[model samples]
Target: MSSAPSIPSAPSTHPAPPAGWQATFSEAVRLQSENRWEQALTLLLPLAEQMPHEASVQNLTAVLLAQHGRLAEAVVLWQRLLAADPGNVALVANLGRACWMLERKQQALEYFSLAVQLQPQDPLALLNMGAIHQGEGRFEEALAWYERVFAVDPHHVQALFNSAQLHADAGRFTRAHELYRRVLAIDSKHVIAQAQLIFTQHYLEHPSPAQLSALARRLGAQCAAQSPVFSNWLVSFEPERPLRIGLLSADLHDHPVGYFIEGLLAHSAGKEVTWIAYANNEKRTALTERIAPAFSAWNEVFRWSDDQLAARIRSDRIDILLDLSGMGSGHRLGVLARRPAPVQVNWLGYFGTTGLPGVQAVIADPRCVPEPEEHWFSERVWRLPSTRYCFTPPKNAPEVAELPALRQGALTFGCFQTLAKINPRVIAAWARIAQRAPQARWRIRCGVKSSEEDRRSLAQRLVQAGIAADRFKVEAPLERQRYLASYGEIDVALDTFPYPGGTTSAEALWMGVPTLTLSTPGMLGRQGEQIMGAAGMAENWICFDEDAYVDRAVALAQRSAWLALAEQRRAMREQVAGSALFDNARFSRDWHELVRNIWRDACEQVISRSSQGISGPKP
Candidate 1:
């Protein structure tokens, strides 16, 4: 939906109008302020028709029309009003915002430029201009506007948030953290700020696990206090019957979560579980269309308020709610805080603890989150037998070509993880690996499309680490087919340490390349270990420390025939296709048993509490 145009800052300076026009305008303005849209339109429509040349009447009518999704009509009205008074800063900004929302990018920029020229100090004009630049992927230019806004209004939350987001995207975590803290200091309850603050911590060089857990707990408490409670609804649990499982995620369509979830959904096709998926994705895709038929019920609840979503879950009487998005995008932590479902589980889409007390457990394997490290999580750990995820590669992937490094004399060690994962320490480790492995050139794909600045920064880091600039290539992102095929060029894949790649590792394994990972104590750092274990490649590849990590990569490269066989790709496919990583049926059975056990335990707790005449969260 299009937002209503902002009210013009400059009032009309025309001579005194005819009879009672001022009273009608005042009543109209009062109605609009109260959000009585129809009544406001009723009052303003005739006035606009009577005085077509009046700037206020035209601007007000355009705003009302824009609010109702009449963008074309509103744009025309704005143009007419601007012709009369082109100096109105708010009017120009509103016009620019509407055009931007309508996807008229160039026109929006022109209007925003005019607005900024008219009133350089206007925060709205600066913000709107920044948004236009950001939309076009000119982040540096966008930062200039946000900085200007901050200079004028130190407490402007939006300006701070946008600037922080840009910094985070560019992998400047420290600056992002500082700005996020500033936002929280101004408005502690800001949802995005709270969530992103927790997210940026993992990027720090030596993030404290205790500090992360504490932050989660604090955010959970805030959410619990703010959202409505559903303590009375716990009595709705029924243990004797089959469970109605509700899976929640925004990435239920063509994402890593979606690929892993397909196997479970397919394998559980005849199970007794009643599947209900609450999708938080704003727009539907072809992938969503394909996956929709598998679920007993699918709800597109992206627009639903937290209270409304919680009420819906309660009304559905869902026995167990599994959230795939732990701290990532499209998460409804507030809804989970209400405890609408009897049992809540945190699964994929995040690495660290959710810090939510309402979440009862997290699904994992012993390799991912060892017993000693369980204190890092707020939820109980439910370990699976082999792997936490059963990955299904895209059906359209091209046939894996012969390893390019094998045919050529030199080895190509590649990693397709994001720029954020490739920190200075990781680069130094890769440099050591390069020194040990003779004629091995590093090729790192910045998983997303990158700017020249991003590529240059990464290249500079590699150069500073005593590696020749020409020895490594920092390539921009590739299209999907080409991305999968590029793995063919690599002899071995090197995983990022501390915060390793999850889906990228899986994809590398699927494309017939072996990924070497360094496993740390934290759960966020051990996903590659679990993923490699699932593929039956962890025995020699998972490293304990930096030396071992470098040694493993050197070992893989030094061993001839490691990437030689033309049939190597086919053989790797057979191994993975039959292994636990891609075994859908096995994963489905494990998931079913786990859900039943958790549900049974929850029901038993409810029964015991009732008999003892006590009521609280399920034990």
Candidate 2:
């Protein structure tokens, strides 16, 4: 009776309440539009509960759940929506994205393919498909998808940029250059495209110091204007506390970035910094195991939803978040945008601006970010004294063999990089070198197995360059130890242009195979030049234009004695190993300084926030 008396009002039903469910839904939508996601969720949840049979409500709920980092719940809700409305392309696309976040790549691809089929002209669909293919290392397939996006929306910046990168990676300099130019045409101030163009031009023609400096100045100003300095942003910080530093990367395992990071971790072992690794890759390898112990905590973040990952980093009291996979495959730039850390830096893995607003600094060396050209980064340039990155060969690495002894009379010119690096222009240059030095036989080894498709593509390219497939020796993927040993068979390793081999060049040098590099303008394109300089092989660093690159290749190939001095170079390898190329201690000191600076700045920000009685947002 008391309960009945308390519930006696029940009067709103007669007045139909102040507003209907639709009005309440609209209010919730407005809250969502204002980015008050929690408020929106609170209001929508009740409405959704009342309208469980409504597909639109369910879809909206799913989206809200996704935004709130309730990915599993969102996925279930999305599945229910899709079951009710299987023909919804938007739902399919969203579901695909969720699946991708969940690391259910196959399911994501199937959904994406269906969405693409349904919305053939949809740029987003094409981009998503392209991304999936790119992640799978099916560059050609990714290129096709990106091309379709470009065909539909010619000014699609991402598609244009990514396609250009794909072309550059594939060694299609002409195509890559054209696409980069197209991007610039659309937005001349596009710093990345401008840098890439300069890089491409440098690959085509090694610019002199005057040219490099001029380009560097222009790039510096552009970068400075674009760089994100935290001073201008309204940043809130939590109280001073034990700082956690999270590093986000797709290359946490046996990649160039991994090689560079080894020394830094070992040096930081006793430091106050708490290092956390957020690996965004699915393929776990021995290198992963090797690197895991270096971190205070290692997380495979590829499976976490972006929001969830961001929340986790925030919860860890991370002060500085370093993005190592800047725009590279499996990058979490979206999460970075959420401002998971008080300060974020882009370093090591990417040389160019991330074009993201959240990153605070980009770690560079004086050589990479020369004083006059410090303006090209979107983040403030944090210059390391020696080098921004340092390479270290695995312990117990094999000894380099003399090429003269191994090659017999046939000179073997090798390029042990991904096939994608062997662009048409590179193939042509190598062919010209081969034509010049008839005794030289080319040996190409890519990390990818010599699949029939790869063989046909490469063979077609070589054939077009007037080189017979029979004259070329192609090898399949090799293990790290065996891969290093394979370089012993080479007289010299030919470095790629526009996107020169970084770790590959260092590894080649470690194996006593001198690498010949063509220095380009951008840091990304001239990495080989940098590595060679660091390795004390500046003479071997071929600073040449395209024509000169071929000429140099021919000249180096003709110097059979120098090329044959594998034993002498082996002595040099020891020197190179002792040099900055593999000097982990020196590199570690540089890294420590750079990170300490970042951490100090973050700590100051925390202090400032606390003084102002504005506690920093929880991670």
- For model 1, how does the per-residue alpha-carbon lDDT over 283-402 read when each residue is reduced to its tens digit? 566667777788889987775668778888988878889999877877889889988887889997877788877888888887998888898888988888898888877678767667
On the 0 to 100 scale, the lDDT of residue 327 in model 2 is 49
Find the candidate with the highest lDDT and give its number.
1
Count of clashes, each model: 0, 10
- Give Cα distance to truth, residue 263, candidate 1, Å: 2.5
Per-residue lDDT tens digits of candidate 2, residues 1-619?
Answer: 0110011111122222234788888888898776667788898898776776666667788888887667878877777666656667887888888888778888888888888777889998899999888767688889899989988987898899888877776556788889988998888777667666655444453334345445535655555454332232233343334556789998887777888787777767655667888888766667678778878888876656656677778777677888887645567655776667778888887766665556778887755666666555556788777667877676677876766534467667888877766666677788888788877777788755344567567877787888877778776778778888887777877888666887888788777877888766656765777788778777745665878778777776664556446555658677887888788888877676677777667667557766788854321
Once fitted onto the true fold, the runs of candidate 1 whose alpha carbons sit more than 4 angstroms away are 1-118, 559-570, 615-619
Query: The CA-based lDDT of model 1 is what?
Result: 0.81
Q: Quote each prediction's TM-score.
A: 0.85, 0.69
TM-score of 1: 0.85
Which residue pairs of candidate 2 clash?
Answer: 171-423, 220-375, 223-375, 223-376, 224-375, 227-378, 228-378, 237-616, 238-616, 314-619
Off by over 4 Å in 2: 1-51, 64-73, 100-169, 173-254, 276-346, 352-385, 395-407, 418-432, 447-469, 474-482, 520-526, 536-564, 569-577, 594-619
On TM-score, the candidate that comes out on top is: 1
